[model samples]
Target: MNFDELLSHYKAKACIVSVEFFPDGTYGNIRVVAGNKAHCDDMASLNHPFEPGCPYEACFPKNPNFEEHCYCCVHEGKPLHAYVDLYMMGLWLNMFLLPLDSDQENIGYCIYCYDVTPKADSSAMADLSADTAADVLKACIKLRGSGDIKHAFQDVVEDIRQICGSDHCCILLTDDEKCTCSIFAESLRRGSSLYPMARYIEGFYTITETWPGTLAGSTCIILKDERDMDKLREQNPVWSASLDYAGVKSVVLFPLRHGGKLLGYMWALNFNIDDVIKIKETLELTTFFIASEIASYKLLNKLEVMSTIDSLTGIKNRNVMNNYVDQIVEGQVPMPKAVLFADLNGLKRVNDEQGHVAGDKMLRKAASILQSIFHDGEVFRAGGDEFMVLVSEIDESEAQRRIDQVHYLSKITDDVRFSIGLSYGEMDIRAAMRHADECMYADKNAYYMANPELKYR
Candidate 1:
C-alpha cells in the first residue's frame, strides 16, 4: 500500500488515530504530541523519527529537496524510525498510520498511537497522556515489592522493551570501588542474538587499552552528551564487539538514582530508536522510584542487624541467646549439646575496694576469657553478674577440662575470675541452664564457707 493507504488502515484499526510516514522519514514530526504532559513538553521541538542533533534546527541544513524541516535528528545522518505502536501493554486497539515519506530523504517515520481506554474520541489524546503517568507509578511499585533490587530493574527493563517492541534491554550497575560500570541483567528479544556478560565484576565495557569507539566502548555514555560518547565506545572493545555481533545499531541508557546518588543505568538497545522510545520513557520514572524504595529496604535490614547483635562482646545478647535456644529446642534441631553456667567471683569486692572501673576491667577480662575458651559454642551474658555457655559434641570430661583451664589462668593473672558449673544433655535446654545455675550457686556457698574472710556479700 502507498503511504495514504497504510495510514488509513491503521486509523481504522483504532490502534492509531493518525499515521504519517514521510519520504524523508521525518513524518513523526507531524504526529500529534504523546506521553505525559511533562515529557511531551520536554520533547516538543522534534517530530517523529527524531534525527541526531539539537531539536531547534530548521529545514534539514537548507537542502534544496528537503529544505522545509524545522526539527533535526540527534544522529545527524544516521537512519531512524518513528513509529509508535498503538498496542503497548495490550491497552490500546486503535491504530493510526502517518507515513512521513518514502524516499532516501526520509530519515524515518513518526507514529501517534492511541490506547483502548474508552475516553471520548475527542478526549482520547488526553487519556493517552495521563494513562502512562499512572501506569508508570504502578509499575515502579510492583518492581520495588519484588524484593530483589537488581533483578527487579532487569525485569522492568525487559517488560518495557517487550511493550515497545525493542530487540533487547539491559541494565548496567556502577561499581564504585572499581570506578566503572558493568551489565548486571539483560532481556533480549526471542530471535535476536544479544547476550550481555555473565556478571558485573568483570569490566565488560572496556577496550584492549585503546581509544574507545568500538561498539562496546561506545555504549557507555558517561554523561548525556553524544560528543564524547565515541570516546566511551572506543575504550570498550568487548561491548563494541558484542553490539556488532548482535546487529544492534541504536541504544539509550537511562541512569538510575536515589536521592541524587547514582545507582546505575538501564539501557535499551534496538535496530531503531522508535522501538526503544517507549521503554526509555517508562524506565525514566520507574528507575528513580525503584531506587528510593530499595534504599529504604536496605536501611531496615541494616537496623535489624545492629539491634540483634551485642556491641561490646561478639556473641549473642541475652535476649537473642534465649531465642536461639528456644528455636533449637522447639524445632528439635539436633542431639548432643552441653550447657555451662558461669558467674564472676570477687567482682563486688573489687568494685567496693578498688573502684567500679577496676571491677569493669575485671568483668571485661573475664568475658574475654570465656569467649576465648568457648569460642565454638554459644556464650551469653545471662544476667548482670552471670554468663552462660552452651556446647555440643563434648562430654562432661572435656567440659571440666576447659573449666579447669580458665581456673588456672585466673590464678596466674589474679586480675579477674569466674566459677563455672556445667551440664550436658540432648533436650531441655532450659532445664539444663537451671541445673548449671544450681550447681554454680552450690560452689559459691562452698567457697564462702571455706574462706569467710574472702566473702564480699
Candidate 2:
C-alpha cells in the first residue's frame, strides 16, 4: 500500500469519533462515524471500535468527559487538543478535536486519537473508551484499598466478575514446584451447573493431559461461542470435557503473564463481553499486574523456606535453631525443659571413602533417624552432620525414655549411627547446651572405642 492508498485506507478504517454540540456549548450524543477497523488491527494505535449509531455515553458509558471535550472544540470554533491517558485501555491517547462545518449550522467535531503505552502490549488494543477505562481503574483501586485485603485469588476474581458482568470468574495459579494448576479462586453463578463451586475447592489439579491450553504462544484467548470448541478441545481434552459438563457456552481467558512468562490463567465464563475490545483492554490493564504480584508472593515464600530450611536434610537449619534459642531467652518458649545434641558417626569417613553425594545421603539418613526418635520435639540440623532437639513441657522420665529409644535404634543400624547428649530439666539454655555438647563428645569417644574400624578425623 502506497502513502495515498494507506492514507485512504486509514481514513476509511481508522476509528473516528464524532459528536454534535448545541450553540450553548452543550454537546449531543457522540457517535462512531468510521475507522473502527483501524482500532482493532493494533492496540496502541486506536480506540473503541464504536458501533454505528452508538452514543458517546455508550462508548465511555456513564462518563461525560467525551461530550465535554467535543463541546470545547465547538465553542472554540478551532481545532482543540487534549491529552488522555487510558491506563486500563493500555492506551496513552493524544486526542485532537477538529471543528467541522455542519449543514444545519449546528456545531460538530471529530476526534483523532493515538496510543502512547510502552511497546510491550502492542499486539493488542485496549479499545476501552475513557469512561469504561475509569470504571475499571476504580474497581482495581477498590480491590487494592479494601480494608482487609485478602491475598486470595477469590477476592480479585470476585471483584472482576462484578466489573465484567460475567456469569463466572475463575483463577488458576501456577505452582511451579509441583508443576500443578491449583484452583486459586472462583466466583461462579451461585447455582450454575457448570463445574459446581465444590470442584474448585477440591485442592490442586495436576498439569497433565486433563488441563487446558497448548501454550498458544500468546497471552489471550477469546472463545466467542461453541464455534471455538474444536480448537479448545484440541488444545486440552480434559479441560474440554469439564467445560462441556459444566454447560459452559462461552469463555474469555487471559494468561496472567509477566514479561512473556505465563504465571497462570484468569477467565470469565458466559460473559459475551458486550464490547470484546474493552474487555481485552481492561484485562490488559490488570492481569499482568496480578501476575507480577503473585510471582513476587511466590518468590518471597520460596525465599522464606530456603532461609529457614536445610536443603540437604530437609529439616530446620541453624538459623531456626538460633531463633528458637532467642525465643527461650525471651521467655517465649519455656526455656526448653530438655535439650539433646546429636552428632552423626563416620560422616567424615563416608565423605572420604565414597563421595560427597554419599555423604549427603548419609547426612540425610542420620537427620531422619534423629527426627524419628524426637518426633514430638523440635529438631534442627545444627551443623554439618550434627542435629539438635529441644523438648519443652516433657518430664525427665519421658525425655530419658526417648533417648534410650534412640540408642536402641542406633545400635540396630550400621550406617545411621549418631551420638546423643541429653540435659533434662534445664532452665538456662546456655547451661543445657554446654552440658549436652560435652555428653555428645563423651558418647562419640565410647562409640569409637567399641568400633575402631570406623575411626575417623
Top-TM-score structure, candidate number: 2
Q: Write the per-residue lDDT of candidate 1 for residues 1-457, one digit (tens) a residue.
A: 1433343444221111122335443334332222333223334544534322323223112111111111222223222222111211222233333334424453444333333342214333222335456656566766757777667766776776666566777656665666676665678788776655453335553432222222221212221223233434565646556555556565555455555455666666663444333343355445546556656755786787666655554456688777778777787555337888888878888888999888877777777888888877878877666888877678778888899988877777775667677777737777787888888888778867887888885
Give model 2's TM-score versus the native structure. 0.67
Number of clashing pairs per prediction, in order: 63, 6
The lDDT, on a scale of 0 to 1, for candidate 1 is: 0.54
Error of 2 at 71 (Å): 30
**Full-model lDDT for every candidate:** 0.54, 0.67
lDDT per residue for candidate 2 within 1-457, as digits (tens), equals 1222322445323444556666554466677454444544443334644454556544443433345456555555655443433433444444455665554466354544444454444223233467556855665675566654345456777777776667888777675666666666688767655664456444445532233334333335666556467767876776677678777777777767565455777888877545454565566567755776667666877999999999989999999999989988898877878899999888888889999989898888777877887777899999988899998778889888888887787778667787889898877998899999999999999989999987875
